[model samples]
Target: MNARHDHSHQREFNLEDREFRFLVSFLSRETGIVLSEHKRQMVCGRLVKRLRSLGMRDFAAYCALLDSPAAGAEVEHLVNAITTNITNFFREPHHFDHLRHQVLEPRLSQSPKKPRIRIWSAGCSSGQEPYSIAMVMAEVLKPSEAWDALILATDIDTNMLKRGADGIYSAEDAAHIPENYRKRFVRRLHNDSDHVQMADELRRLIRFKRLNLHEKWPMKGKFDAIFCRNVAIYFDKPTQRALFNRYADMLHVGGMLYLGHAESLIGMNDRFEASDKTVYRRIR
Candidate 1:
C-alpha cells in the first residue's frame, strides 16, 4: 500500500475547498505532482505533520502560510511533505539483471577506447537505487579505474538527497539487496549493528542533487541508462509523455530506460520500443 493507505484515522482537520484547490494547483504547477480530488484525504494526512510543525491549527492556516511572505523557505518542506518516497533496495530486480547482462556486459567487449558509463536514478529516494546500481557497475567493471563510470541520483526532496548522500540505511534495508551485491557495496556499522553504510568505493560513484523534474535539467551529455521507475505514476498522462520524451532526449540513441512494473510508455511516447517488460530502448 503506497499513498493510498487509509489515513482517516489521524486527527481530522477542517480542510476547506479553497485551500484544497490551492494546494492541488500549487503542487501541480511547482513539482508536476498532481493531487486529484480523490487524494484529498491522503494529502491532508501527509501534510498534517507540517501543519503541526509550523504551529498552525488547521489547513486554512497552513494554506495561508503557503501564500504568505514567509512561503519561500517553506516551499522545500512543502514538497518534502507532499511527495511520497516509496522505494527499496533492488525493488525491481529484473531491471538490474538487464542492466548487468544486457547493458554493461555488452560494453565490456567494446573497442580499446575505454567506454564511458553514465546511469541516472531519477527520483532516487534515500540512495538505495543508485547505490545498488553502483554495486552492479563496480562489479561488472571492476578495476573500474579503466572506465569513467558515474551515477547521477536526483530527487525533488532535498532531505532525501541528503540522506542518500549520507549512504546510511537501516539494517533491514540491506536485506532486500541481493547477497552478492550486499557483501560488496555495503558494510554494517561497527558500533550500531542496526544500520549499514554503503562502502566508500561505491559511494564515490554517485552524485545526489535536488532536482525538480519539471524544470530544465542541467546535465550536458547523454546517459547510457536512466532508471525512472515508479516516478511518473503520480503524474498525468500528458506529463508522463513529456517527461519520457525529455528522458529520451537525455539518453544516447540506444540507451535503456527502466520504468516501474505498473508504468509503461505505450501510447504515450513513440521514440522508444519495448525491449523488455516495463523497459524501453530509444529508437527514434
Candidate 2:
C-alpha cells in the first residue's frame, strides 16, 4: 500500500475566491456544469479527496496544477469526482409506470408490425435506469426474439459507465424493482446474496457508453423515447433549453421525453407538449 494511505483524513484547505471562480468557470466552459457560489463547500469537499490523492496540500497548489499543461488529462478524473452518481432500480417509479403503460405497451401493439424499439437513458448513472427500461421491455416484448429492442445508456463519467456495464448492485436495491420483474431480471451473487447482478437478458439489452451531453453527440438515429431524468437540473436554463432542443431533434416525432420531477420544460422549448406529469411528447 502507499504511505499516503497512512495520513489522517482530517486534512483541510481554505479554498480561495480566485481558485473557486477559476474552477467554476473552467468546469462550466469545459463541461457545461454550472457551479454556483452556494456549491463552494460541496466542490471543496469533493475535490479535497482528489487533492489528497495527488498529495496536494492546498487548494492553490491544486489550482496551479490544474491550470498547467500537464493537467489536460486530469479533467475526466475531476469530473468523475464531482459528477453526482445517485441512482437506483426503478427510481422515480412513476416514470417506469409511464414507460410501461404509455410507451412500450402501445408500441408492442402497433398494427403495422413495429420490429424496432429504441430507448435512450441519457444520464444512466450506474446502469439502473437503462436496466429498468430493459426489464420492462423484456416482459412486454414477449418472445423477445421478435423485436429489436435496444437501450442506449450514456453518461459523462467513465467510472459510472464501467459500473453500468458491470451490472452489479447492492442486494438491497432489488426492492425498488417490481416483484414480478425482479425474479426474471435479477440474480443473487454466488458468494453474496446481499448483492445482485442484472440477468444476462437484461444486460444484453443495453449498450453503455460515455457521453457528455453538452458536447457533440455522435449517435445517428432518432430514438422512440429518451429518458434524461434529473440530468438537466444542474445545467443553466440556456443549456437545458439547448439540450432539450437537441433531444427534440434526436427523438422521433411523437416520441416520449421523461424529465426529473424537479425539472420542467416550461418557457424553455416548444417542440414538446406535456403528455404526463413531468413527461413531454415530441410534437413538432
Clashing pairs in 2: none
Q: Candidate 1, residues 1-284: lDDT per residue as tens digits?
A: 54443454233465778999999988888889988899888888888889888888788888888888889978899899888898888888889899998799899877356789999999998888998899889999878888889999999999999999999999998999888888777888998989999999988999999889989899999999999988998799889989999999999999999999999888999999999879899997
| Every model's TM-score | 0.93, 0.93
TM-score of 2: 0.93
Task: Compute the lDDT of residue 65 as modeled in candidate 2.
Answer: 81
Number of backbone-clashing residue pairs for each candidate, in the order shown:
0, 0
| Local accuracy of candidate 2 as per-residue lDDT tens digits, 1-284 | 35565443344466779989989988888889998899998899899888889998888888888898989768888889888998888888888888889888888778336489899999888988999999989998877888888999999899999989999988888789888998888888898978899999988899999888989999999999999988998899889989999999999999999999899998999999999999999999
- Model 2 residue runs over 4 Å out of place are 1-12, 111-114
